[model samples]
Target: MTQGLDQQHPQEHRDRAILETITQEGRSDYNLVELARLYIRYDNFPGARQIQQDLQAILAQWNLTVEELFTLTRAIHQQGQIYRRTKSGEDIQDWS
Candidate 1:
């Protein structure tokens, strides 16, 4: 239950780091998007949706254009397709 970062597999360590940062800052469009993607992959659908809503609010606060929103959403979707966000925190490369 309490694995040390050094003890974790490299991929697991990186995965845990990302999750931690997301919780710690939970700010910035980039971080939110990444967290959302991870949530989606990890089967936390509601959390992912919430992050998306947060993303929308962030975009609105910045006065971004519809075109910008479309672009960002597209990129996020594409990434979700590319990366298999697993709860195990396994390294993507290790899949091979």
Candidate 2:
């Protein structure tokens, strides 16, 4: 039974272990964003909301206005999509 369970969701177990390590190291906005992404990917909306709250707080503390942050987030998301589509796995090239 234990082996069956282990084999059934190996990636989930790995993700949990990684999350545990990150939590033990203490939470940060960057960590929260990563957690949110992981939760979203796994279809865990509640967990993602919690992380999003943390991210909001961090953005507030940094005095990042909502528009600026949204712009940054959109750019990052778009870049990731482009990289994934290209399959070259290269970093996004700087325009300036």
Candidate 3:
């Protein structure tokens, strides 16, 4: 299942957190070209700047541009990664 960015997994490393936070939620397909814009929007919030820096570092490490990373993430998310859960905390697949 595609994990929502609102909850951080304890085992997730720092670089992974940055990628998930910026891309995994709250986006329009049209905004993919401007994916980095959210960093500017959230810059005033506490800890956001550090995230921006970390994202840059991750890009450098992976030798990827922002657009490339977005494409990759979008493909992964599209591949049946998203799932729904019931309010009682049951997987949707269980109800099928």
lDDT of each: 0.50, 0.47, 0.47
In candidate 2, residue 16 scores what lDDT? 58
The TM-score between candidate 3 and the true structure equals: 0.40
Per-candidate clashes come to 0, 0, 0
Worst 10 residues of 2 by lDDT: 1-10
Candidate 1 versus truth, CA RMSD in Å, comes to 11.0
- Give one digit per residue, the lDDT tens place, for model 2 in 1-96: 232332223245555564665566645444444444454444423233434455455446556655665555566666554332335655442211
- Candidates in descending TM-score order: 3, 2, 1
When sorted by lDDT, best at the front, the candidate numbers are 1, 3, 2
Model 2 ranges with Cα > 4 A deviation? 1-10, 44-87, 90-96
Model 3 C-alpha lDDT per residue in residues 1-96, reported as the tens digit of each score:
222323432323543453565455534432332334443333343443445565566556557787676676567558742446679766543110
Which stretch of 10 consecutive residues in model 1 shows the poorest summed lDDT?
A: 1-10
lDDT of 3: 0.47
Q: Please tell me which model should have the higher TM-score, number 1 or number 3.
A: 3
